[model samples]
Target chain A: MVTAVRAWPRPAGRAPAVLGILCTAVGAAFVASLAVGAFPIGIGRIVEILADMAVPGNASGSFDQDAAVLLSIRLPRAVLAVCTGAGLGMAGAVMQGLFRNPLADPAVIGVSSGAALGAAIAIVGVSLLPTAFRVAGGFLLPGAAFTSAVITTALVYRAGRQDGASGMHSMLLAGIAFNAIAFAGVGTLSFIASDEQLRNLSFWSLGSLGQASRDLVMTSSIAAAVGALLLWRLAPALNALALGAAEAAHLGVDVRGLERRAVLLVALVVGALVAATGVISFVGLVAPHIVRLACGPDHRIVLPGAALFGAALMLAADAVARTVAAPAELPVGVLTTAVGAPFFLGLLLRARRASGL
Target chain B: MRGVLLAACLTLAVTHASAAPPARVVSVGGAVTEMVYALGAGTALVGADSTSIHPSEAGRLPRVGYMRQLSAEGVLSLKPALVLATAEAGPPAVLEQIRGAGVRLERLHVRHSPEAVRENIRTIADALGRGTAGDALLQRFDADWRATRTRIAGLPTRPRVLFVMAHGGAPMVGGRDTAADAMLELAGAANAASGITGYKPLTAEAALAAAPDVILVTDQALEAGGIDALLQRPGLALTPAGRAKRVATMDAVLLLGFGPRLPQAVDELATKVRAW
Candidate 1:
């Protein structure tokens, strides 16, 4: 269930408090994600491990399983969650603003479907790659996914663009068509794939933080940071564009340029995020809405606020995924969708009630 | 011979802890778990993945999750000195993390062949320091395999068999490059679905055209709907196998696991085919 955007009267005075609360929540979730896991590392022990690792030359000869689990397994996974969540959240806010519509997210630009197609191809064709190429096989899936996502977005943009004005309306339609095509491609691959390949493809689609590594986290963090900073800089432009493209143009905002830049930035950031995390749904579509409901529709606060909130939400979901089944972890994406869909439905109902519709 | 023995010891030392067998072991693959139990090291198993359902006792061990999607923390939580996994067990990084935690990790080079079974048993045996037990198991497996080959060689006809795996959706028939195909080949039978590779949904035309003399299904598949229900499907009902009701069902794991019990599986399937 979804509803069209209603410009909530700006709660300008309360924005700072909301941001502060979100920041604190994110910090808490990060600590919790680090401390709780399948292995029973107590909070005190976690803190001690943290302190031990902080000191120079403390890399002990004795392989401490607790420390390895904390550092190698959970820490990178948590960091990846934060980076991916933040990128998806901010991208969602930007898409909602740029399109002047509430429902627009990266999927509206075919990023998710394109990434899925690319990943399916990689999974099925990986054995065909030369041994030398297969040695770096870990990167191949994400690399292909990212490349295809950008290409899909670019094609959609081209198809949507007409005259000099940004055809945001047609872009949405093109995205829908492309998404179907890409998904069909993925379906065909699944039919032809071996059982193992099918398993890999399904796992990739379900999404997990299990594949997280320091390098993946590092790359995602840089991409998310860049997207957030650049998008945050364009917050004022986005704010103006929110008041109808024609009206914003009259007020000296370059409406066409803003739409182009916003779509490109969202594609780049969300592509990288999806490639790393394997199609985590709901965070991008719902995170910004949650922030806007809390602090009103102000891009400046909504951007950072949504990013922090999304990071917190992802950390909490990932924590549950890691611990709920103990040794058998649930896919983090499944947990997010399970929790997010209901919460989103509730939001839609509340919005309808508030609007007296 | 001394040089070979010396090289073996040196290899073992580098891969495993020096001269001492691991006190506790975690088995990640079903076949790996089977070998561990068959080698008389079952008591040493502290944890196993979800696929390790064979041997009954293995099912009682603490589950570490699916073999392919293992968690490092879960495996480490078992506090095992060694982890024995089939080559298929991983997200790769998880395996590396387990190794980094100073655990001896042995990944068997598995394939759908008897040679691989011998190699896996030998590797698992050496890893568990049960070299004598490994030899005995190998001898028993070889004898059974030789007897099976002899029986199949004496057979007059190689029947056409189809392996239909039905679980909820449209039933998929096993084709070329599948473990089912390998099993059929070993059991003095030709695969009816050899035209296609892997598993594909059984089309009415394909099923009728294959004209199998015997239809093979998993025990679990047969449980879902009886042999009558399977044979009643439109495509299957017209086939020679369906007309005669010559359907054989076997435990899916034992049939496809390609582990120590592979000889038993092949022999059983072949005997059933001959009887039909």
Candidate 2:
């Protein structure tokens, strides 16, 4: 069915325009997030509040509580959601191109698991350190996760090499091994943790945006933006790689450099997000696939389109998380699974039918 | 005048005091054990749950297994005449079995309110033939509690606080209706995470949302990532609590245990919050 779909002609510029509309829709949802919550604030109040914040001494009693709520809570959450979503989406797009497989994701490379293990160690092992040594442990977790991810990818790349040539299958197997090892490490940490620590670890491992702050959001967004831009520059090369390494090299693509840069960028984006949020699953896996369905296989359109769609999906999921249980919010990751799993299954079934498999 | 004299004579002839029954005592919970000890009737305690770990000497007594996972065999082994228990003390079946065995079990109410605590103390005292002792202890406890609270009452502002029970992984926080909240209120500090109820896992985002002035946690919990781990948690690092090094650590058992030494814990907490 995928090949059949590929045979169909698509109108020029339609996908980008559709993506533009999706971006606007996501932006509107972001605004809606600012307006709705336990505080009972409306859109008018939200606008007024933003206006007041922008202009000092602008007397607006209508937006006082709304302003406080937005400035203090909603804005940070929305921004974080966008950054996380965009990062995951772009990373997914890059992975799919590099692997020449639509199913490729950040998780397939064990980046999320590695980051989670790092976070768990930071949380569980920091207590044993001296007071002077304790000050660095917080950043150390994420730092460790990033380092581990880079190392893991390097090792994966190395192990996947056959007579100085690497293939998607070898990379996939290495990723599986890395993910299993990281999960085992996390399990060990969980086992030795105190009952209270165990509870906290479980919740953290589930992934949440509850910790998104202005600084965190900014840092994560910047990292993701950088990754997206780099991936955009490498799009034509990625497109060539999709046709197979031998064909791509023959077509003047530096397959090794392309693979290295793409893997590194994915690691950085996934590591930064996971470090901040603790292993939010499925966004990277689903976002690229969804965008591909709408826009087809061209990396030029697929990369940017995935970023916008991914942000929209995550923000919508987060909005659902905040409101579904009212004041007691569910974890953002849980909400994603509840939505993403079904969508994923549907895609799988559709693909099976299309392929006659 | 003669009618008044007849009424006085009748009142004098009618002595209204009756001897109360000695509580057939089966103290079924840890808190109940402490209360029993507070009531000066530790000897009357026929049995206790595994969590009744206070007063040091209470451990030598027979254990009735864990608090929620009660065993009928362990409880019935004591052959308690009357069972005094906290609301949390049971696997309902074990409690029922004990009751079916003709054991008189009184469920002592647990509350976060100061008045409730005093009343519970009095109720336990009354059951143990030491009502006067309960009254006297309460008076002292109340006086000291008020004195400590009053000292901080004059402070210009109260600190917004977050009470973290566990550190590392996901940090669990105390919201409304929790022992941590009750303790914070008594210490004259506001709970940052008051929007929810009970013990909830606070997201880094929610912690940042609360923007606590003081991050309160137990020593053991803080040790997980030490100060670094606390600071590294998304929103926590930028908060006043994280910035000013206003993180306060208290003994976990004393802070949430709600035992005989809570007044002291309150005093210590108030001092820390005031300084913060």
Q: How many residue pairs clash in each candidate?
A: 0, 11
lDDT of 1 at B14: 60
lDDT tens readout by residue for model 1, A299-319: 988899878888888999999
Model 2 segments more than 4 A misplaced = A1-13, A56-65, A132-141, A161-163, A346-357, B1-276
lDDT, model 2, position A47? 76
DockQ of 1: 0.57
For candidate 2, lDDT tens digit of each residue in B76-181? Answer: 4455556778876653434655565556677876676666667777777766556677788788778877887787677667889998877555677888878889
Q: B178 in model 2: Cα distance from truth in Å? A: 19
The 10-residue segment with the lowest total lDDT in model 2 chain B: B12-21
Per-model TM-score versus the true fold: 0.93, 0.56
Give me the candidate number with maximum TM-score: 1
TM-score of 2: 0.56
Q: How far does residue B261 in candidate 1 sit from its true spot (Å)?
A: 0.7
Give residue B137's error in model 2 in angstroms: 7.9
